[model samples]
Target: MTTQKKVSRQVTLELEAGNAAMVDIGKMLGPTGVNTRQLKLDYDEATAPQRGEIVPVVVTVFEDRSYALRYKTPPTAHLIRKAVGLEKGAGRPGSQTVAKLSREQLREIAERKLPDLNTDDVEAAMRQIAGTARSMGVLVAD
Candidate 1:
């Protein structure tokens, strides 16, 4: 007997942890599907960080109405805020500095974000993070 292979489709969504909706998910599932309830549960379970941060998710829906989920890291701007303990970035980024970070602190952030950063070494990752921080009105010191 020949084996049948189920085809899977991928949909990327920026879902707030534990607060997904049927309408948003239904749009991805299309008119022919009815497994949105299960998909919502899966999204909530996968993003249990409790901070309600928006996360990029890749949902692979199979032919049988079953789905797999992949959660990506939070954005660099969010990570920088957490690292600097700020509620928001500076409004006037060029004229105002909201926070500061040491080289060691930047390095730690770089290491934590190494998996998500598109860089070969920690130094390059740190540079990228530094650029993000600067854009957010955070000064990085040596």
Candidate 2:
């Protein structure tokens, strides 16, 4: 019996959901000559729900040019921006306030992010969310 060992490398990219172009894939993959058609199709399907949002994608490329894709949840900053109806986070995180979110909203955002968070408890997750809010100049208040 013979076993074949595969060599692979991982590349992380922030791709626009359902809108990945050949040029973008080419730039990320370099001259490796991987299959961009299949990659585009799969990426589009996986990121369908997150259209218009920049989401992180991890691509594992093998020696034979075959690759696999993994999608990561959007960052806390991104989620906070969405919740506060802001186009982007504050230019100066400190000494500048861009938006405000209530405690209830903070909990809600934390709950939505629980699955992706490192903590198991909701309160712990809420605290983490609050920290991100603070960095983004989103004051968590009443």
Candidate 3:
């Protein structure tokens, strides 16, 4: 049986899906002695389907310089803005309402975010996401 390599370090980065800049990758992984070029190609290929979203990636570098990557879904704010068709959140969250989102839409977003969320209960997840929406001046409709 093959044994897993010892992890040398771990780095987390948020990159544009499928279009991460080589310069950014080199800047982050170069100091670690990891192969930045290979990492960029692999990341771009794996995230191709999520081209327009931002994807959070965790890179685990092994002692031998090999690495593994784990990808997380886009940020809640991004997802919320996409659902509401907005380019950005309100300038003043509580005072200015920018858009509205239905409960169904909330549930869908919660489900999508379940894997990265702290709670297992969908209801709790919905509540957490709703809080984020509220902070962004997005009203959650009944």
By lDDT, the best candidate is 3
Candidate 1 RMSD to the real structure: 3.0
**lDDT, candidate 3, 1-142, per-residue tens:** 9998999889998999999988888888898899898999899999999999999999999999999999998899999999999999989999999999999999999999999999899999999999999999999998
What is residue 46's positional error in candidate 2, in angstroms? 1.8
Task: Give candidate 2's whole-model lDDT.
Answer: 0.85
Estimate, for each residue in 26-127, the C-alpha lDDT of model 1 and write its tens digit: 887765374888878878886776446767788777787666778887778887898789999999997899999889889987887788778769999999
Residue 74 error, candidate 2, Å: 1.0
**lDDT, candidate 2, 19-137, per-residue tens:** 88768888888676788788888998989888987778889888898887878877778788888899987889889999999888899888877878888899999999999999888
Clashes of each: 0, 0, 0
Please identify model 2 stretches exceeding 4 Å from their true place.
1-5
Question: How high is each candidate's TM-score?
Answer: 0.75, 0.84, 0.94
> What's the best-to-worst order under lDDT?
3, 2, 1
Local error of candidate 1 at residue 80 (angstroms): 0.8
Clashes of 1: 0
